[model samples]
Target: MDVKLPEGLEAFLAAAGWGDAVIEPLAGDASFRRYFRLRLGEQSAMLMDAPPPTEDPAPFLRAAKWLDANGLRAPRILAEDAPRGLVLLEDFGEVRVREYLDQWPADEAEVYRAAIDALVELRRLPPGPFLDYSLAEYQREAKLFVDWYCSARGLDVDAASYSAAWEEVLSPMLPRQRPGVVVLRDYHAENIMLLGSLGDQGLLDFQDALVGHPAYDLVSLLQDARRDVAPELEAQMLDYYLSKTGAGADFTADYARLGAQRNAKIVGIFVRLWKRDGKPRYLDYIPRVWALLERDLAHPALAPVARWFDANVPAGLREAGGGSWQP
Candidate 1:
C-alpha cells in the first residue's frame, strides 16, 4: 500500500528549494512512520512521514537535538512541519553495522568496540526529563514482551509469579548500579552506521533513549537479534567495558542477569511484531534470542526466572512454529 504524504509536504520541499530532488521510499519499522531518501544534486536528505493520530515526530526531533548536543551522531533535523508530522533530516548513508559486519567479519570486534565506546560516551551525559530510564519504566517496557508474546501464545503465565520472580532478580540488581546516564534503548547493529572516516558510529532510531542501567546498552549491542557475536568476543567486550568503567566484580553477574532479561523481552517483542503488526519477518530472529535467553538463564543470576520459564512456558512453545491461536 502506498503511504499518502502529509498535506503541504510538496510545498515545504518547494519552499526549501528542494522541489527538484528525487524522493524514493526507504525501509521502515513496525510503526506507522515511513522514511524516504531524497537526492538533490550532491546533497541527500531523509524525509520522515509520520502520520498524525497514530504517529508523531516530536520525540524524534527532541531526541535528535539531545543526541547532537551530547556528542552523538543522530540525524540532523534539516526541516520540520510538526502540524503535518513531516521532517527532513540529513541522510547518514546506508552502511549499517549489520551490512559492514556481513562484508567484513574481521572488523566485527573493532566496529563493536567503537559502538560500545559511543554508548559509554552517551552514558556520561547528565540526566534530563526528556530521557526517562527509571526502573519502573524499564520493567513496564520489559513486560510488553510478556503481554504481547506470552498472551498471544496462549501461555498460562501466573502474573504474580512472574512479577515476583522479576522483582527477585531485578530489584537488588537495580540499586547496585552506579550513577545513571543516557541509554540508547536499542543500541544494536541495525541502528548503528559504520561510516568509514566518521570516528564515532552514526546513531539512528534512538527516540526512546533513557537514563538507566549502564550495562543495558552493552547487552543490546552484544546480544543482538540479527547477528551471532561469538561468546569469546562477547566476553572480551564485557571485560573491556568493565575495565573502562572500573565497575566491581559483581558487575559480571549483573551483566548476565541484564542480558537474560533483555533477551527474554526481545523474544516477546519479536513475536509481538509478528502477531500484532503483521510483520512476520521478525520471527526469524526468535531462535537466536531464545538461545541467548536460555544461556543467560544458565547463569546463577537468573535462576528464579529460568526455573519459572522452564516449568511454565511449555516445551512446544519454546521454538517458532506455524499456527495461530484464536485466543
Candidate 2:
C-alpha cells in the first residue's frame, strides 16, 4: 500500500528544515487528502497533503487554531505551505479510541464517558468561525441518500417528497441553533485520539466544524457507522450527557432528527465514494448506517422523513446492497 509522494513535496519538506526525515505513508480516510508520518531521529510530525482544487488545508488550520486556543487538543501546526496544500503537524501518537475500545471492550463506558464530557464542554463554548448548519444544508445532505443510495439500489424514489420531508422535520430545529455551538461534524471514536488518558482526547478531522445543533455531534458519536455501539451503552451515554448539560426536553427529539439526517448523509456519501471515487470498501458500512438511520426514524420528530422512507424505500432494499452493490 505504498503511495507515491506528491510533486514538489521534497522541496517543501526541505525548506521546512526536515530534509533528512524518514517518510512513511499513513492510513487515509474518505477524502482526497493523504497523510505521511515524518520522523527526524527522535522527533515526529505528520505531513498532510490535501492537494489543491479537491482539498484544502486552510479550514484545517483554522479549526486547529480555534480548538487549541480553547484548550482542546488538535494537532499543533509545525509548518505550512497552504498554497501547495502541505502542512506539517504534531503527531498525536497511535492510540486511536476506536481501535483501543475494540481490544478493551470493558473500558467502553469509561471511554465514551470522556467523549461525551468533551461534547458537553463544547456546548458551553460559543460558536466558532464557521457557517450555520442551515435547514437547506440539512436537506441537501439528506438528499444524498436519494441521489446516490437509491440510484445504486436501482430504486427510483420520490426525490421531491424526500426533500420536503427533510425540510419539514429539520426546519423547527434550525431556530434552536440561533447562537449555535461549534459542532464537530465527525466526532466519532475513529476521529479521536486517546492521548495518555481517556479524558485527555485529541481531536482530528474537524475541518468541517459548523455552528449547528448541540445534539448533532452526539448523534455522530452514539450512532457510529464504522463500529457497533451497544444499545445499552448508547442509552447510558445519552442520559449522562443530559444529566451533565441539563438540556431541554426537546434535546431528545433534536438528537433523533439530527441522527437521521447525519446517517442518511453518510449512507449517500458511502455510496458516492464507491460509485464516484472508486472506493468500494466504504459500502461495507452501509448496513450499519442503515440500522442507525432506522433507529432514528422511530423517534416522533422524524415522522415526515419516516413516512417518505415507508412510501419509497422498502425495508428489504434499505440495506440489501452494502458490499455487493454494483453500479
In terms of lDDT, the best-performing candidate is 2
The count of residue-pair clashes in candidate 1 stands at: 0
lDDT of 2 by residue, 1-327 (tens): 658998888899899899899999998889989999999999999999998989999999999999999888899998998988999999999999999998999999999999998888889998889999888788889888889988987787899989988989988888887799999899999999998997888999999888999999999999998989999999999999999999998999999999999999999999999999989888889889988888899999999999999998876675553335654
- Candidate 2's C-alpha runs over 4 A off are 319-327
Clashing pairs in 2: none
Per-residue alpha-carbon lDDT of model 1 for 24-140, expressed as tens digits? 887788677899889999999989898787888888788888888877888888888877888998888998888878988988888877877886676667764465455676577
lDDT of 2: 0.90
lDDT of 2 at 220: 93
- What range of 10 consecutive residues in model 1 has the weakest lDDT sum? 318-327
- Each candidate structure's TM-score, on Cα atoms with residue i matched to residue i, is 0.92, 0.97
